[model samples]
Structures are given as structure tokens and as C-alpha cells.
Target: MAPDQTNSADVLIAPAPGPGALRHRLEEAILGDIASGRLAPGTALPPSRTLADALGISRWVVTEAYGHLVGKGVLEARTGSATRVAAVAPVAVPDGAARRVAPAPRLERAPDRATHDLAPGVPDLRHVPRDAWLRAAREALAGATNQDLGAQPPAGHPAARAAVATHLRRSRIVSGPDDAVVLTRGAADGMSRIAAALATAGHTHLLVEDPSWAALRDAAAAAGLTPVPVPVDDAGISPGRLRAEAARTGARAALLTPAHQFPLGAALPDERRAALLDWAREVDGLLIEDDYDAEFRYDRRPVPALQGLDPDRVLLLGSTSKTLAPAFGIGWMVVPQRWRAPVLDVSVRRGPAPGPATLDQLTLARFVGDGAYARYLRAARARYARRRAALLTALERELPGARIGGIAAGMHVTVDLAGVRVGPAGAGGDDAAVVDGRDGVDAAAADFAALDAAAVVREGAARDVALVDLRRYQAAPSARSTVLVVGYGNLADARLPAAIRGLRAAVEAASAEAAGAGAGAARAGPTGAAAGSVG
Candidate 1:
């Protein structure tokens, strides 16, 4: 029943109370009503006389019950108005069922105790233009109608899709509206939809970049699709390797980060991009292009999206998480004609892809159409460029000879620790962890790098410097080593130097510990064994 139509009198029941238990029965009934949402906040209760006549109970019994509930804070009575359910009354929710949904931002924030945050993918929220956003929001709210708040069609709001279409065409060289654009909660959510659609079409395997973002692999798995890791190189995902993997695994779709590869930050070269598209075309497969963080290109002009190259064979997934703020659950996918029906089917059943609030979608529509988004991007690009510069400078000054790459774009930089020694001397051996059964890197060497990175991370944590080791981004346990993914987006210029300085000190301490262990092993080598009882 509609909330407005649920009559308070209709919900009440006549009770057969025994031995002075009338008040207890009435209280239980009212509590159940509130718990089940029958007695909604601000909903007026029935007049004492009316309820007494219906229930055939004493009016004072009803009034006493009401008065008792008011005392318990379950109901409230104003001087001239009827008693109503208290706005803050606690509901007796089922176990494990939340009465309220807690909000979690797509971006991560440093813990309160942390002094510095170098974690990657976190945006500097200070960059959000509050005045512009508020203006857009107010405009959207003022223009909304009662019908706008009603059940919307499955595809999405028309204004939002149209706005997204215009934005894509102008910024990414992609075009389409209404039917072409499929709204999602975020990039991961888009991947799940695509994966589900592909699975429904009888394709169960997806090719994802090795050492890629874990979310891509996880989303595919959640959609009942197996993720096969295809190794990546400086140019981007190795097209040759990907083709071979697809052939072996019968994967009909490949998820890629062509514009700016996550954690690795390599723009797919023109030739590789062409090769990838050719592979997709030949196999009659699909490419899920995660166009995340492509707008903040620092070294050169942004690369055109892979979906723009061949929209029919590529599904472009882009989100406002990086460009605007992660809190706004707004993202879009440019779907091909062939997959539109199935894609829309799954998305609609999910009930509002990304399930964005109506006001958010409208505000985003206005923000994009009015050029406020572009202006914000331009200003943010400048700010991130400066932060990236500061981080690089700090790294160079504090830890010379460390190799940092993938800095041309994206919010994070990759620090290669191949040359750094992090374990005891004796721990160095010939074996290395091979990524994708390809690169025969020394396992011990990678361990040493991981140890070094861990020590630095621990010291940073103790000192309130929040940083992460690069290994965390790898999908498989042995997929990567010898690197630290340093995100500079969350740190300020003044704090970069100090954080880097602490990181260097931690590294030195770890080196000393390793060296001392090696020396102790050397001292114990001869004495620990009985001098040749040649057994």
C-alpha cells in the first residue's frame, strides 16, 4: 500500500488482554507498526475516541498507551496537533539487514591518524568546484517535476544520456545518444554488465591485462566470467600475447586500459591499438576500453578512446570518478548495436544502472552542457600537473637512482625497484618469479624488492605516511614485483618532500637489517655444523 494510503486506524487490532496486560499489548502493537513502517514518521495517529470505539477498549487505555509511547520516545505529541511517530524512532530491523545504507565513496581517504597519503587513485577532493556544482544542483532541483521522481525507463534519464553523448563526441570523438549510451554506477559496474551480456551470449572467458587493476578481474568473476590474464608491456597489453590467450581460452572479450594503463600508465601505441582491434575483429570478440583517468594527460594531448576507433567491436567504459569526484555515482558505456538488447536487458533489471540519485543525474547533465565540467577539468589538470612535478622532484632528491616511470599520465607513478637490494645477501638466488610464465625474473630478487617496499610502507605507516606497494595491484600472487605504485594525487606539495624523506630512511633501515642478517649467517656458517661427521 502507498505510504499516504495506509490508515493508522486500519492497522490497529482489538486485543483480549488478561490480568491488567492491556497496556502491554497496545505498546507491542504500536512498536510493531513503527518497525514495519506502517506508522511512518510524521504520520498522525488516530484520535483516542475513534480508536477506542473501533477497538472496543477504554479511551483511557488507548490514551494511556499513547502517553506511555510518548514517554518512551516512540511517539511525540505537540500542544495542538495529533501524536505521531517520532522521526528518530528505532526500527526493529531483521538481523544483518541495515535500516540505513552507509555511504562509501569510490575514492579512498587516508585514515584519521595518517599524516601523509600516497595511495594511488584517490583524487584531491579540494579540486571540486563547489560553487559551480551547487549552482548546477540547484538548477536541477528547481526544474524537477513530480513525474521526474517517478519510475524512470530502464535505459536512463534522457537528459543525462543526451548530455553524455554530447560530452563524448566533443571530448573523446565518440558519438551516440539514447540507444548508444548505457549508464552504469562506475567502471566496475559497467564491466559487470558487459560481462553478464557476454556470458548470456555464451562467451565465458575475458582477457584482462596482467598486473592490471584488480577490480576488472573481480567484476568479471562476479559476472560468472573467467578472467585470463594477458601479459602487458611498455606499449600496453601485448597484442600478440592477448591473441594467443584468447585462442587458447576461447575468450570473446578483452578488457584493456589503452588510454592510460592502470599502475603501468602506458598509452597503447598506434600500431598495438590497430593490432588489438584487428584481433578483436578476427575473433568476432569485444574490447572493453576503460577510459579512466584519460583526461589528465600531462605529457601530451590525450589519446583518442579505443571505442572511437571501432565502436562496433569496442565497448567504452568511462566514469566521473576520476574526472569529477568518486562520490557521484555517474558513469556511461557506449554500447554497440549488436549487443544493445542484451546489455540493456541486464542493466534495466538491475534497476537504474549505478542507481544514481535523480538530482545527481540532472545536475551532471547541466554541468556537462554548460562547460563547467571542462573548466573544472582544465583547472584540475593544472593542479595535478603541479602535484606530479612535486612528487617526482621529491623522489629524485630523496632516493636517487630509483627508476620511476608511467608518469606521463594518470594520478600515480610506478617506481621500479629492480636495482634495489632489499633482502639478506644470502637470500639472493638464481630463481625469479616469472609473470605470465614469461619473464624469468629472480624470485629472490622480487622478494627483496617486496621486502624493501614493505619496510618502507611499514615505516611510512608508523610515521603516518600512507603508501602502498605496487604488488597490491597485481591480480595474481606472482604476477609482478620490484615496484611501488606511488599515488601523488592525495598529497600536498609541502608534504611530498617529508614523506619521500621518511620513505628513504625506511629503505636504509631495511638495507641495514638485511646486511646484518647476511653477516650473522656468514659468522654462523662454519660453527653451527659438527666438523664433518660425514653422515
Candidate 2:
């Protein structure tokens, strides 16, 4: 058998080589072509003689390149057969295209393999009511009609919306008709939809809490709305600051977590809630309330949804992510009548409705309607209460000087390190500057001047105890104090004692080092000279 004649027009287009041996360059060119899909699998290559002649290189160069590629299984060369491309080739990924094709950026870090995981924003997934969920799913499938199985309206199934409305009215005092509700995949999805509507309505800016949920802030940015940060104190976001920010930025929309604020954990007081409502009405602005984890208050009664005060101006968002399980993918947005049409239009424009499956939505409807949801919450609340108590007891014993902020409602508590002396007395009052956006803000720099929360996180990790620094959630740095948002929901009761002990060791080590540095600085005056020395 004779080798096929190499046609010039059919020759593989190898990229021009630079600064390498001839054989190596040829090998790289061939591999590059295969990786870029220019050389399709099973496609025959030109004879070594023909390629060498065309490229004005020695035939040995081409032969060596082919031999090298064959060794790597990138090309198949059988005796008496053409050297064709291999059947399985490397996937083609153009330069700078990996970011575009990467999965959605994780809002939070992946859970560590630490024995004690105090990562915030995660619920106790072990407690998921599998039996109840299976029952609800079976009932949903059994009763689903032809219409129910079909594509539902972008707003959601009528029954699912009504069930959600009823749950809100009964549990959170948020009164609204069924039509006012819009189902979503989660609270993050709801925020994205609302942000789209606001952007479409010619709104350019969104007011967000300084140290708020990074996911919701990203959602607003993804919809082309700039998020303006308003500082949050112990009592959540201040209405006065919010109003002033709204006036300054001309932002007509604000995303808040009034019912147990994220990370900080402050439930907005009634007067502040009313003031916020007044601000919304006065500016004709919209308030996006993220009602995450409001059902697990351990100390006192759960704060009612802020939407209850002024449903027309406030958009209430809630999800089963915390109450049931994030796997449920069930969330609701009680849209004000004025914003419903625009939000629905944005949802439709974004392609299929942003929600769970029809069957899943129906299952949720049945789950909420049959009172199983309430019963589950009661059990979860009790379990979480016990966990919270154990955590509080341990924190008190281990970190006695640390001030815990936020309400006792949510799954996490904020450990304020400002009061815990990392340096000499009166050496930690310097305020850090705030920056816009969520990423690349250094916790060590943006947190309280004298304490390094990042150091604590590192030391904690070394002790096999996971920790999250609060500055990670800040859209803008807080000047108040450094905080650790420690979540106890996912941490098992048995692990609490050891976890606190390990955490305490880390804090002590980091604090001692910081204090030493502070003392050295004090001994050596401001100009790095010996104290009381003249230049």
C-alpha cells in the first residue's frame, strides 16, 4: 500500500513557532491544533516528507514530532496506515475563555474538612425531614392535573402562590393576595429579578447594607445595578443613613435583611423599621427585604416581616433554604402591586421562569398547606435552640471578653473582637477606610485597626476549627470593629466543646503576637527611634 499524496490545500494549519528547537516547536504546534479542535479526531495528517518540504525543515523534524505525539496518545500511527488524529482528543478551550465557561462563582467558601465547621449561612442539613418530603412529593404527583404538569406562568402556580401567601400571613404577619407572590429558585433569584426590574425602570443604583450577604449584592450587580453601601451599626442598617444615602446616590431601590440581618444578626427595631418605610414612601423607592432564617429565634418571639408595615413599598423575600432545606429550591417574593408587572416582564425576558420544577413547587404547596411545614419548623427550632445554647455556653467559657452581636434569632452569632484586647489598651481605636464592591477587601486591613481577624481565621484553620471573618461579607468595610460570624447550625453538639477550645487557643495565640508587636512599636517611638531619643 502506498501513502496517500499530501495535498497542499489540505495541509494542517500549524501555528508559527517561536524560540524553540524545530522538533519541539513542531510537536507543540501539532498538540496545539489538536487541543484547539483544528485537528479533528480521526483526521489524517500529511506525510512527514510532504510537511517537511512545505515547511522547509528536515524530514527528521516532522518524523520526530509525529513520533512524540504518538507516544502521548495524541495521534494514532499504525503500520501501513495513515497517522490520523486520535479518537479522543483534549477539549478545546480558547485563551481567556475559562472564566466565561466556569461555574457560577461561589458566594461562600467551600466547607473545610475541619472537624468543627462554623461556616455561616448554612443550615443543619442533617435534620432535613426526608420522610415528610417524600410524602409531600407523592401527594403532589398524585393530585397534579394536566395543567399543573404543564409550564406554569412566570409568576408561579396559583396554588403554590396562595399557599406561600397564607404561610407568610400566618407566620410573619405579611399580608398579601396570592397574585402578589412570585415564586423563585431562592432569595438570590428573587433579588436578581427585582434588580432587573429596577434597572429596566431606569434605576441606576441599589442601596445595600455595608456588611451584607455577598450573593444578593452580586445579584444586583449581575443585573447592571450599582450597589451603594450604607453602614450598619448594631441595630441593623440605620434609616437615617439609608435616607441620606438614597438622597445622595439617587438610588430608588434598597436590598435589606431587616428580619435578622445576615452576619451582623441585628433585627431592625420597630421604630427603625417604620422610619425605613417612611424613607421608602418619601423617596418613592423600593425596599427589598431578605427574610432569611427568621423562624429560628431562640431568645424571644421572631420579628415580624417588615413588609407587614407597608406592603406597597416593601418587597418581602423568603426561602426554604434555611427553614426546610436549600435542596428544596423553594423561595417566594411578595411583590408590591406596582412592581409585579415589571418584575414578571424581567422574569419572562430572562427565559424560563426562575424557579424549581412544577412538581417540586406543588410538593412545597402541599407541604406548607398540610401543616407539615409548621410542625417541621417547631422541631428544627427546638433542635437549633439547644445547639445555640451549647454554643453560647462554650463561647462564654472560652471567649469571655468577646462581645457577641446580632440577635439570638438566626443560626449564627457575631463575635466582636474589638473588645477583646489584641494590643495594648487605647492602641486599637484607628478606623479603617471603606471600599465599594465585595471582592478583594482585605479583612486584616478593613477590620478594626489593631486586631487581625484574618490571623484568627488562619490559626483556627490550623486547629482544625473552621471560621469565617465578618469582613468577607462587607461590600464596604466597617469602621466599628472586627467580627467573626460563627455559625453553630451545622456544628454537631458533641463537637461544640472541642471546637470552642480550639478556637480559644487560636484567639489567644494571635492576640499575644499582636500585643507583642504593639508593645515593640510603643517602646520604639513613632520614628522607629528609641523612646525619648532626639533626631
RMSD to truth, every model: 17.5, 18.2
Per-residue accuracy of model 1 over 215-295 as CA lDDT, tens digit each = 878999999999999888887899889988988999979999998998788888999999999998998989999998988
Q: Once model 1 is optimally superposed onto the true structure by TM-score, how far is the C-alpha of residue 158 displaced, in angstroms?
A: 1.0
lDDT, candidates in the order shown: 0.73, 0.78
Show where candidate 1 strays beyond 4 Å.
Answer: 1-113, 352-354, 420-451, 526-535
Any idea how many clashes model 2 has?
A: 0
**TM-score of candidate 1 against the unseen true structure:** 0.72
Which 10-residue span in candidate 1 carries the lowest summed lDDT?
Answer: 94-103
Q: Which residue pairs in model 2 clash with each other?
A: none
Provide the lDDT at 132 for model 2.
Answer: 82
* Candidate 2: residue 187 lDDT (0-100): 93
Q: Model 1, residue 280: what's the lDDT?
A: 86
Best by lDDT: 2
Per residue, candidate 2 scores C-alpha lDDT tens digits across 1-535 of: 2333544235543333345576876676676666655667777888887666434457788898889878878788999877877788554443322322333555574633466788787787656777688899999999999988877689888889999999899989997898999999999999999998999899999999988899999999999999999998888999889888888989988999898888788888888988888888888999999999998898877888888888899999989998876778889899999999999998788676557788888998999999999998988888789878888887876665578877778899988765553222212223211121111223332222255777789889988889998888987655533579999877766567778877777776666555446556666766789877878
